[model samples]
Target: MKKLFIAALLFVGMVSFAQDAAQPVKQQRERLTPEQRNEKHLKKLTTELNLDTNQQAQVAKLLADRSAKAQKHMEMRKARKDSSIKPTAEEKAALKKEIMDEKTATEAQMKSILNAEQYKKWTAMRDENKEKMKDKMKERKNKL
Candidate 1:
């Protein structure tokens, strides 16, 4: 009876460890970095849109530039959060305007990179991706 109890405990512990190990691997795969996402988007565009060399180069550069700007904006927001200081209403409005303006500029750049037909397709793909991401996030929240 004593030997059997020890064996059962060992088995339980091993099963617990195996379960814990698998979770982190699954979570890591789900958590994508901004750079990784940008690269994936570029690859998708190339494959789906059948971009030529010049178009690919232009799109790649546009994506990289937009990604860098977005990272900078995110860092600024993090810094603001870490400071434990709240902005005034006017300041908040100004910041919102700035972000919107930046988005407008980025959209213009995308327009310059893509022709009319490609832009329409690109916009559709972007909307579909946003919906897919929303669904994924909802599922993740329910799991938590």
Candidate 2:
């Protein structure tokens, strides 16, 4: 009986070590360059909206501009985060207002660029993505 118990303990230890050894390593993914990302996004939009050459050029330019602005915003945000300073209520309100303004401007630009049907489809896609983001945030909150 003592011999059997010792063998069972040894088996459990080996199984635990085997499970740990079999676990997969997480790999770091290569990120695309900004230009490459922009081009890929443009191609997707072209395919989805059936954009003409002229529209494609315009959209590409628009995307590049938007990307630049977003990059700048991200840098500023990172700097603020690094500073470790909490924003005041008024500052938070101002930042929220600025984001809303940018959002409205982008929507207006999209409406100008796309035809009625394309704009409608684009809005639908945007809303769907927004919902997905909200769901993801909720899931993260729940997890935490």
Q: Which candidate leads the pack in TM-score?
A: 2
CA error at residue 72 for candidate 2, angstroms:
1.1
Instruction: Specify the poorest-scoring 10-residue window by lDDT in model 2.
Output: 1-10
lDDT of 2 by residue, 72-119 (tens): 766766688899988889988897787778778878988899999999
Candidate 1, residues 65-105: lDDT per residue as tens digits? 77777677667766888998888899989978987787678
lDDT of 1: 0.71
The local distance difference test score of model 2 is 0.73
Candidate 2: which stretches are off by over 4 Å? 1-27
Stretches of candidate 1 off by over 4 Å are 1-25, 30-36, 137-144
